[model samples]
Target: MSEQPKPLPLVISPPRRREKPPRHLADLTLEERQERAAELGLPAFRAKQVSAHYFERLTDDAEQMTDLPAGQRVEIVQGFLPGLMTSLRTMQADRGTTVKTLWKLFDGALVESVLMRYTDRATICISSQAGCAMACPFCATGQGGLQRNMSTAEIVHQVVVGARAMARGEVAGGPGRLSNVVFMGMGEPLANYKAVIGAVRRLTDPAPHGLGLSARHVTVSTVGLVPRIKQLADEGIPVTLALSLHAPDDELRNELVPINTHFSVAETVDAAKEYFDKTGRRVSIEYAMMRDINDQAWRADLLADVLNERGRGWVHVNLIPLNPTPGSKWTASDPADEREFVRRLEAKGISTTVRDTRGDEIDAACGQLAATES
Candidate 1:
């Protein structure tokens, strides 16, 4: 028909290439970075130099790295140190002693870290994943669902950035050192096993390889990933293991920590005991007190009984007041209920303390602010 408008040859265009995700220095291990530099025709030692710049100096700028050859600095920085996190917003409270920053990763994934300064120490709470896979109903982060596991570098970069900020006197009360690192920010630390462990090494390793912080000052928290917990125990690094055990009995724990469905309370507790036996570092039992939910006096007694049965030493209970996320029905227990809960645990000869609540004003609770934005 009309030369059939002989169908023009179909010309298919190649699909547009997807942009590579932004690379943070924290994403690579020392060996991997050395290999990458080799691929770029740079000397093996250049990787160590770059690491020193990023980890010790806390600067990715090639110009600032006087130690590296001027010609090689640009390529090293471009090839190995692409920006990984962008600060979105920061809020401070508690007389500026507590500062929380919301960061957007290269892929638009968001996580947060809080830097709290005390007279004696400074602690940075870091996230192991972009969001949480553990659907703890009361937690804001758990509700957002998991986006992806953070790379080792991504996890370590959070601490490096915080450390840099502290060194520069950016946070309140002038210059300070990052004394502690806690995996209590967002996501389950054990879920992303390899990367989390790699980050731990990078954090505790000596300068040129890591920030060189002591392993003892680091704490890794999990919602009781039984097998992984045991695996961690075998790693030989004695970082504190924090078990988020909200409920003492199986019935409530099963609902509160869905993973309990996979590993029963007894099994989880046994795993923690194994960890204690291996590392000799007392495990921290993290209990978030929610009104009428798991705060009943009887439940507290049951919790103490379980801990006592496990043995008197090598475990401590850190009672946290539920930081109610926006629009959530869960609320913190009344003062009397909280006091009684602690009293019961102590009566059982268990050491307990109410966790100091910080960052309340700035969605300081792990996933609250990020959830709202997402």
Candidate 2:
């Protein structure tokens, strides 16, 4: 009895907050908008007009908001719709079909968002956190450590800008609305749960209040935050859930995804299964193929086996070619190995596909460009 030790205390990491999120259009509720409009001494109707211009029309340019009186346009724009970010520089590849824009936040925090133009549909990849708290050795963003959790408005602003660019036919493949959004940018989205979820709501909510994007077209990715995964399931959102399962076994995942120490691979999959069960949307397993690191054919078979053990009709695998970060020893798997990895997964009845790389020429590896500037 004397030798028995006390149980380890449960330590919950507080969500990091460096600076307050600026009061902007995307961060406010419809009622809050009215309140802010009143505070600015503008009629409540002006709030609706501003919402239409910002959320639906996708233009924050005061001059462009002509519905508001000429003198009040700038005031309305400056009041509730104060822009949260400015594009620093934009780079392109694939004949300008892949565009990556680095954005400067009000607090001087840098984040990136990429818009990919395909003939069928356009997709935008946006950052949820400024840097990242998860110290995944293979990721460039993790190398710098977490700067701050991006506000819901900060996350939504990136899409609004992309939507505006698409509307003006700036991106290639002609003018089109953004058909998809992926939370696969600078940080672990689930780590900033509230802001990420709030952004999703604002993206999916109907017009004049939100971007009106389809919930199904949005994908929220996490590096296996088990509890958060379960929490997201209960949020009643129908969006797809993508788990960044870089490795199939705990032993390897513990190294590739540092957070795996808290939530093992099996636990991660179980949580994903819960998501699928709740939403009726299949879980996407994002596997970044590191050359000879986790790219072995045997590992692929093990990955397939693990997914198969969870049963079928609930999970799909997206095998990504690792985009080499500067000076990093990790690199993409050989083409032949990537093919074999896919073949092995499919052979075992697990649905899999090699993800198409975008913005490679521009070094669109999330925080890679910003890290250089710093």
TM-score for each model: 0.92, 0.95
Candidate 2, residue 88: CA error in Å?
1.1
Clashes of each: 3, 0
- lDDT for predicted candidate 2 compared with the true structure: 0.87
- Per residue, candidate 2 scores C-alpha lDDT tens digits across 33-139 of 89998999988888888889988989888988877889777777888877688889999999989999999888898899999988888899999988887878889
In TM-score terms, which candidate is top?
A: 2
List ranges where model 1 is wrong by over 4 Å.
1-25
Q: How good is model 2 by TM-score? A: 0.95
Show where candidate 2 strays beyond 4 Å: 1-17
Instruction: List per-prediction Cα lDDT, in the order shown.
Output: 0.86, 0.87
* Candidate 1: residue 293 lDDT (0-100): 89
